[model samples]
Target chain A: AGDAEAGKGKIGLCVACHGTDGKGIMPMYPNLNGQNATYLESALKAYRDGNRTGGTAPIMAPMAANLSDQDIADIAAYYSQL
Target chain B: AGDAEAGKGKIGLCVACHGTDGKGIMPMYPNLNGQNATYLESALKAYRDGNRTGGTAPIMAPMAANLSDQDIADIAAYYSQL
Candidate 1:
């Protein structure tokens, strides 16, 4: 797990669709709160590396591209805590 | 719009993740029941054409590749009705 404090600041990109609470704004977006951090990190990494290939990847892939390994761990840590 | 009766036969590929009722098998898999028909069709098309690139596309894209426009519409109609 990475620092939750560091992740809080970088989560703005996620709040628009996944929500500030990670509950999500639509049925298509899916919830992120309380999800497994390892799963979340892997998913983010997949999107960043062009492995994840779904309709919503365009929006999420760019966001993942902006994160570092530590940032992914931090973001996953923050959401998993919620 | 498509024939709901026709859609019933084409939804098997979706049942593993989305369930027979389109409710989804896991938290990571989103529910598809009662969602907008148009949204479902568009989502499927997006997955088919490789425009919806997301984590789950790998599973869904290949399935969508086998479906026609009518198949998509019918499947969407079936799920939206559920």
Candidate 2:
């Protein structure tokens, strides 16, 4: 449902914590490598909408707030595959 | 890899926070509904082994500490399909 190539190009904002390989850079961060695409998409949407909160939500909400559905989908696709 | 029925029987400890429907009862708690099974299993294992830290780790660690791999798998399976 999303273009992974496009997602890869759009990952600049994510790489610092999530890493280029989708593995979290820190212990507190959850790993995204091989995660579920649908789950990722929903999580991103929830973040963008300010529906998901707590833990890293404060950090993630601002980052995800501007993402379009397509952006969320692409990012999800990119990360789900590792 | 896991029996949902078996997992269903093991959810007593999880229901207080996660709910019987796998949806988290509180915003700070993550909803386990339809989450990725592999991710859930790994996360439970991480909590049990004290490899995952920060946020709710202190609370989760003790809860997950005694779970066998089979218990983790069954729980994962149960939550993943919710």
Candidate 3:
């Protein structure tokens, strides 16, 4: 759960929107810094599987679709520590 | 968004920890229904101005320092119309 290095590579695309610090670039983006890992995983999966919707969903869907389970886990772990 | 009956009476202490359709009944509590009423009033004024900590921030800093700014904008417009 502490693999920040691996998560960095996997979540590279997210930085454009979520910011490298995970503080979110805008109010519309949502600061993920210090968010719970379990919650992050659930939300990401929801976005991937079409359970959640928003202006960001279209962009997120494709990005989430390409991630493996491990990738998702690692990213969540990394963001939790941010 | 629309107001949900004065945010169900000023959130009523957030339903003992977010429930009744806002989702989060557990897992560290964080559903907030549909969310996004200016990001739930910027995360409840960043947990009532302490800059957002975990463990529920000492019961959400005395319930958001007694909420008055139109009751946090009508409970963030009633949880963004959850």
Candidate 4:
């Protein structure tokens, strides 16, 4: 199942923009709180695969470049609950 | 002071993905609640200027492209408090 606490541990870089609350820093960075894990997983996968291009994609593509599928799940899970 | 009320009015489009509470829909869209106004403002400006590019930037760029500085500010102000 989605583990919010586990995801929180993995969000080091994510917190830089998205913020600790998952509320996002604003403007470009989006809010992560209460988003569906499915959408989060898909977007992260797209960023990792280079299918999606937009603001911070380059950065996220690289950041997500090494993430395992499970990691994506965990991160998505954590933010979704927020 | 930041007008959360006024910002809420302009956040109609934002709420589509971000949700009414500023919590993002998940994985892709970010949470908007409790983010810093300055950070939100900067991010929005980046989207407007095409400086930051990533997952949703294309849609956001065009979405934000038409916004004036004050609009950006207002939106930022709105989301930061949420």
Candidate 5:
């Protein structure tokens, strides 16, 4: 997947909760750094589609709503490298 | 949180993708068996709220749409134990 500088900006909201390192700030946040890219991609889609549910739903549903398939792939690539 | 047998039924959808053990069979699925509870909870919410995005969005968005806060918490507890 190609790196999108635009996607990096989109990830800011994620950094706020997951941290720049993807280690996550609170117990409520997950460590996204080094997570499997394919897995992360599925998770993002699941959140968008509503297959998963939890405390972060309110925050995730909207974030995922607008993502294109390519955007999802790109983000997944970024997180996988972190 | 109290163990909800009912919640267990709801998690079946997750099992299909995450596997009964949470190890995840596909590259697209994440291992949920041992994720941190608080982190998992927040993630679920992020999906529900549309803050996260990815390949599994279509499936996840609708799944989380109807979940109650308690249901989310109970499921998080179960996944944490797995």
Candidate 6:
């Protein structure tokens, strides 16, 4: 598991869509609060790797493009606990 | 909106992976507890329509293939409330 504090610092890019509390700002976006950390990690990695596509993939791909594995893990940890 | 009682009757195929409680039985699957109903509905529709691909898409596609719009709505409603 990654550090939640570190993840919080990296969530600036995510808050615009997922919100500070991990709830999506729009219906099209899924809420991240209390989601499984493993699932979130995999989803983030999929977005970063260009292995997932559909719906908001176009937007997420770019946002996740620069994330490292540690970044993904941290973000997942933070969101899963929300 | 969908009827939760109706959805419960339709979860026979879902229990193997998502479990009866909407929590995935494995790390590879996502926990559906407390998800947004709209997002869950859209996701189910995407799977049924072949519009989304990646990760568990292959598995989900077949499972969702026979679902009608009402089935999707009811299932989403049931899972979102879990």
Q: What TM-score against the true fold does each predicted structure earn?
A: 0.57, 0.55, 0.59, 0.59, 0.55, 0.88
**Tens-place lDDT digits, model 6, residues A42-76:** 78887788866666778899999999999998998
Top candidate by lDDT: 6
Docking class of 1: incorrect
Off by over 4 Å in 4: A1-35, A38-63, B23-28, B51-54
lDDT of 4 at A11: 86
Q: Which of the two, 1 or 6, has more DockQ?
A: 6
State the lDDT of candidate 4 residue by residue for B1-82, as single tens digits.
4466777778766887777677766545666666667656766777788764556777777778878777777887887776
Give per-residue CA lDDT, model 3, range A37-68, as digits (tens). 76777667766776544445566778898777
- Runs in model 6 deviating more than 4 A are none
The fnat of each candidate, in order, is 0.16, 0.00, 0.11, 0.22, 0.62, 0.53
Segments of candidate 2 deviating more than 4 angstroms: A1-82
Q: What tens digits encode model 5's per-residue C-alpha lDDT throughout B1-82? A: 5254655766866777776666767766666765667777666766688755555656676777777778788787787676
**On a 0 to 1 DockQ scale, where is model 3?**
0.12
lDDT per residue for candidate 6 within B1-82, as digits (tens), equals: 7777799889889999999898889877898877888888878887888866767878999999999999988998888888
Assess chain B of each prediction and give its TM-score: 0.94, 0.97, 0.30, 0.87, 0.81, 0.96
Candidate 2, position A19, lDDT? 86
DockQ of each: 0.17, 0.08, 0.12, 0.19, 0.32, 0.59
Error of 2 at A75 (Å): 11
Q: Candidate 6 chain A: worst 10 consecutive residues by lDDT?
A: A46-55
Task: Give the whole-model CA lDDT for all candidates, comma-separated.
Answer: 0.77, 0.78, 0.69, 0.73, 0.69, 0.85
Q: Write the per-residue lDDT of candidate 1 for residues B3-73, one digit (tens) a residue.
A: 88899999888888777887657745656666667667767887788764556767778989989999999
Query: What C-alpha root-mean-square deviation, in Å, does candidate 3 show against the real structure?
Result: 10.5
lDDT of 5 at B38: 76
lDDT of 3 by residue, B1-82 (tens): 4366787778887777775566666655666665556667755765676654444556676889888767876887776676
